[model samples]
Target: MKALLILLISAIITWTLALWKTTRVTSATELSSLGFGWPLQWIEQDQSRFQWASYPQDARLTFVKFDQLPAYVDWGLFAANVLIIACALLVIYFSFPLILRMFRK
Candidate 1:
């Protein structure tokens, strides 16, 4: 029972750390707004002459680009939330048995 409790605590900590790390990663790369109006207008006005000049070209690209969060980070956050919930459930399940036994005695 003690071991199970320890496992549950460890799992909870691991899950929490994973979620925190994921959140930090998201906060670091998230873009406030995408300056896309010019690009879109250019495309509509003249498809052949359309150029992505307004876009940040000089910024160093990351492996996980903030501008592309909807494509990647959103789903990652959803999955992490699910995993955190699952870990919480496991902690409850493992601890419940011991709790019940203590009450029975």
Candidate 2:
């Protein structure tokens, strides 16, 4: 239950941040890179579309809007990423104590 709660909370927070940042962005050019551990920063480009991106560990840099595609695509990717990370964290959180106990013996 705790793990679920943690995951939900984490997802909500990350989604909120990403969504909020996304709103501030008007063009896809603002996103510089995609993948893990990239800090969100402003990068100017000629593109005028939207793309959904996910950054790890509160790092910035995610979301892009492209012409013709639905905004939901980006949001879906964002949600998936948030869930993946939350799940990973939940696993680590639960396992850490057990791992420590094993090593202590």
lDDT of each: 0.38, 0.48
Off-target runs (Cα >4 Å) in candidate 2 are 1-4, 12-73
Residue-by-residue lDDT tens digits, candidate 1, 2-41: 5566556654554444333311112212233211111011
Question: lDDT at 104 for candidate 2?
Answer: 100
Model 2 lDDT on a 0 to 1 scale: 0.48
TM-score of 1: 0.32
Candidate 1: misplaced stretches above 4 Å?
A: 1-73
Pairs of residues clashing in candidate 1: none
Evaluated at residue 76, the lDDT of candidate 2 is 53
Clashes of each: 0, 10
